[model samples]
Target: MMKKSFATLTSVLLGSVVVLSACGSGDSSTGTPAPGGTPSGGASGEKVTVTLAGWTSSADEKELLQQTLNEFEKKNPNIKVNYEVIADQYMDVMKTRLIGGNGPDVFYLDAFEAPGLIQTGVVEPLDGYVTADFDTADFEQPLLAAFQTGGKTYGFPKDFSTLAMFYNKKDFKEAGITNPPKTWEELQDAAKKLTKSENGKVVRYGFGAAPEIARQMYMMKAFGGQVSDDKGSATFASPEALKGLQLVTDMHNVEKTSGEPKEVGAGWTGEMFGQGKASIVFEGNWAIPFLQTNYKDLEYGTAELPTVNGKKGTMAFPVAYVMNKDSKQKDASWKLLSYLTGKEGMKTWTSKGFALPTRKSVAAELGYDKDPLRAAIVAGASYATPWVDKATLPTIMNNFNNQFIEAYSGKAKLEDAMKKAQDTANKEISAAK
Candidate 1:
């Protein structure tokens, strides 16, 4: 699963040594791996155990990953996988282990954190391990690009999710709306019609707005504005960005059609929509299971987000399995990594639908494109902007979210808030440099 909050990489000096024994695996130095990532003795060599580490979001996710590993082990008896759950502070633990030379052979890496980690030279560049049969071209370009830098591949995205509009069917019917909005203007009109007020007091909001940078970055892209420049410094305060962002603030402050989760006493947009406090919300594939488990009676449907300025856009979150550069079992690890992210392996991993496959062939084989609820999500992947930038993204996101809420809550002008947020983020980036 993708990280809920952006975590910045803390620079750690590489000279310090912290000896920690990797668990669940035998000595890995017993085997001499063959060229092109094949285990020694052509499948039945001196056994090597490769460690794969990641933080699991749910028991189901952990079990599914174990099941996938089991299959891999059955295929390659020589390479046993030691699946390790980092449990908490995954990145911090990973960074420490990597610097101390005790990191797992292969580990999970979110697209957001890939750039920063790769820059430290801890993640193995995966291009040399790739062969023609790996079908690297099958992966979604945008998702793959997140783990790439300077024309070299660092990791392969295992899966991805894109934002989609989740609307309550009952609310739509009651408001006499037949279909989802196709444009920003239509969404505003529909939001006004769907908003409910009783006795001059606002009851249910028409839309649940997530006013954070993660959600608003795509909005900025609707105009010509971008999150950063070529140098990775913040540049989101331009007039073009405010043009799209003002639309959100105006809906909440002026039209009063939309409100954030906090205003409705909810913790998140998903909870706000599930509680019937908001008629619509932008969510991803992860919300489906949450709604199913928490609000089984809620009748909701998903659609691709409304187009902005004649262009369709949304944000994508992807995570990959990256090999540790210092891994002694590089060949064995590549075998496991290739299989897990391969078409067949990916299909088995994504069969339960808890996650969406990043491989185009796997997605098509699963028929998510035809499913009523997932079709919109599948459609968005083509045009979705990845929730990834340079190493400065975490700093940029924190400053932007802190100030953007002021504008969303009508406490500050959109232009002023964005200018402050951008200037503050850039200054921090410069100081860090």
Candidate 2:
């Protein structure tokens, strides 16, 4: 799950097939000067291939990406972008290539991995390359800060997704629930009421949950728990953290109103909710297109995540366009990078709604805040925690998720599990450095 398969991907089976209509072609610069092309620089007038690397999600996703690149080529005739698709193990492949000095001029970097890569000095800091037209302030602040360390921006976020609660309208009506829960306690009560059983087996779970660190980080903070310290040490085993997480384990082992998607034979929350096996699930904007295409008949509504301790919070996952520090075409890469994240390019990329735009202006232009299904997701952006931490977050998260599953399943006491996970994570972190 390093590349996060949680992203909604289009396929014939899913019935969500995004069509990518072709854009302009890459004719030589001499053919016709691109309108407002990259500013003149070393070899801006000469044809140069600037390679880009990213992981393609599906045929539709890949095609849409290519369409965006085609648009870039049309605007910058002198710079030809060579797009490379890393099919699997994207981080491993990209890291290897970068260390070997064969990395793409520009490539995709998950915010999760940005901190570690930035620490290695392989990512080109974008602060010096920013143009007033690029508008760094236009980016959602938390997302923009995810790629910055020591006050230097190493990348510009390309797109982002935030967690929001999706509930089945039909289920709610049947259960006699008048409104979506606004607080964690209310959610629990509603979940118990919505859960249905048949012949001693669950017909539908009230909540479909993914017991992982990424989904529960906000919960950790709800009760004033520190997910990790400034030094990247695992500190989520404290009593305060457990207070927040008790709600999850209680929902699973005590209340029994919640279950993982796998328990219902569904691949993910979207599948669980789509098949009517779950009444509610917290998912990102990716779920909207998925439900529309595959479960057209499913009745659903979205809301901002239920408040925890009367506080609003959710998680935001963003991916960035990072240039290689060693790239021979730094200027060309910057030109393409700035344009792709620019207003016009962002609009084109996000118009189809595969992902949400990172730029505030682009988001306002797209009117997602006014979109019925997307409004909740957009609302969470204001208070959501960007899903990034010190470079050791990957390790700490792995340790917590691994042990916490045992607690969720009733095999281990949450108190003991959290302590074990924390100690193990800390030891590993200490060893790594």
Candidate 3:
């Protein structure tokens, strides 16, 4: 699943977490111990509490994180972790607290929001804190790169997920389809055969589509088009981008073989596929647990998304643990941050598969690549695009999604709608600058 904007944070679907004011004492700049306290950087003596804040999608995820923290505490007996849950408006609250200088020592940062927050200079650069023992190279390059800017590291991604095709086995059998499509052309052929209609009312669609920019960015890339240029200006409206996007629009409008969740009165593609309204959907690992819990009887298989223009592509959403530049307990905060993203902690955090580990070692140790349902997802890490860009992405995303929906609904042409979106977004970015 894509990392959503702070404005759209939901307690039910996105999970819950907490934040806290700074507590305890130490040097804010270097993590050196205060006078009469043990030396800093090493967490051997002089107990210090580092506050960690993040949102968990469920109680299990929260507990899993707590277990990791508990292990860190045992290893570094001098440090105590204060876990806080932010119920809603996570980014809004985080930004407010950051500006006020009372933000948590360590917190969760989505890659999509990392660029914007890092540019503010309040995020501590972890390059210095990273040690040889940390094995920085062990992390998947693309995931780690999301938090890097100008060769400086701001955060370490804790976990990530890539989009994969989820197809209902029963639907495939009923449609006389033997396998999932491996290319866009084959996908169209499959869609035509799988579509079921009752008096032209479309009782079932062959594909479920998401019109949001987050989901369509890879589609844009398939044809050598990009969402934004090096300057962070909108470029998705270009002809190359539209060539790939048109496939989706055509599938829904002209071919009439695909539909979004709203068309079937569902909340998301996962639900649309689970309810048998759509035989196939492109979703992330988040949907796996959802179906297992809510649609237990649904028989589905996962596969790497079909290649577009002969190239495989998918969106990767990664979240990291970052330190506040102003934290008084910088040393203790680093301990917590490093431990959580380290091999031992990451293995535990991702053991249950709520999310995929960001570290290559952890993923191989967990054997997710061999797990029947997770293999395709793990295979995508090699080429997945990190869902991130310049700070103006939120604004660009809002405008694009608004207009893209108009095109998806057949109310406007994709080119016209995208041009309007790009113009409006660039104007907003320019005005903000």
Candidate 4:
């Protein structure tokens, strides 16, 4: 399935208005007008409006969120939410407004771009807002840790995605395989057997090789390699990392069981699997909803990504709700942020199976623990490693992704690809420092 991409925020904020209103007539404990109007007989006479920006393309999701916002407004009569839908190109638009000192009070922050934004001093730390009653412990460890930096919390994780093996059940049955592969070697063997051709024309491929950096990052961890060391330096040239890259390259060039991204013309690994051209593809949990909605005819099931040499690992990517440091309404922003990531909102947002809640309690409330696919995603969170490096990730990703494509196409050796990537990343990191 083709996963929905996040839109850049630049265009969304161009004509948007900043809303402000009085809450009540009487002064609050803070001596400020409540939000929208004055307090009347202990009842909130007005409303407080706050702006939030996010990339949500699904009408169902938007309706669900609007319902939740209505509930929040009913409970806290003083607060109202103005949620803005930024379709695509969210980052480019958001960055422009952020640099101009005028942007949404709260916005979405993906794992891939969080580091760069945090480094720019535009995001506010949330430590002062969080209290013991907030129940931070409800969140899973890896998910919660993604937004922490230098002993301060920069954002609250809302949802997460973890890599898992998506297999075509019909293809597996056709290949006479009754069970999914549990280890790297078994995966390779299964791929080879499932691959079929007729008269030199390939009819079906066993796997799809997505030469993107994120997919390769999971493989790197499976081989027990780290993208960066304690001092935050590039380590993609490590022997273990090279081995992981070689595994995928070998699958395409040596095993002849996998097709490159270009060859499949799907633009993504999950799409290839959903089309039945590939038997197995490693993709994130978000692919589940996409597949169910788009390719309802495909008989598919998901499992934990097969282990590498008996050592299990996968990639975890989380998107958090971050507050703007320069917002005129910081308190209102925090309140909205708190509500969205709070237990109730978490349940509502993740209940549709669009993404997994970062909070363990929220996952339980959403019954994810009982759902096999969601359970696998939650379980993978513990052993999952992040694909991003704290420094020079964009440059490193560009270098690695371009060179790795060559290896995937049999135009370059894995070792040579890694060597060039490592050198380029190291130079970029050094210059960045």
Could you list the CA RMSD of all candidates, in the order they appear?
4.2, 5.4, 2.9, 4.9
What TM-score against the true fold does each predicted structure earn? 0.93, 0.90, 0.94, 0.88
Model 3 lDDT tens row, 249-275: 999999999999889898788889889
The per-candidate count of clashes, in order, stands at 0, 0, 5, 26
lDDT for each candidate structure: 0.83, 0.81, 0.84, 0.73
Q: Tens digits of per-residue lDDT for model 2 on 223-308? A: 89988989889999988899889999999899999999889998888788899998999988878877888888988899999999
TM-score of 4: 0.88
Better of 1 and 4 by lDDT: 1
Q: Candidate 3: global Cα-lDDT?
A: 0.84
Tens-place lDDT per residue, model 4, 301-351, is 788888986788887888899987766555666777888899987787777
**Which residue ranges in model 1 land beyond 4 Å of their true spot?**
1-44
Q: Which residue runs does candidate 4 get wrong by more than 4 Å?
A: 1-46, 230-232, 431-433
Once fitted onto the true fold, the runs of candidate 3 whose alpha carbons sit more than 4 angstroms away are 1-44
Candidate number with greatest TM-score: 3
Between prediction 1 and prediction 2, which has the larger lDDT? 1
Error of 4 at 72 (Å): 1.7
- Candidate 1 per-residue lDDT over residues 120-200, each given as its tens digit: 998888898899999988898888988999999999998888989999999999999999998999999999999999999
Report the number of the highest-lDDT candidate. Answer: 3
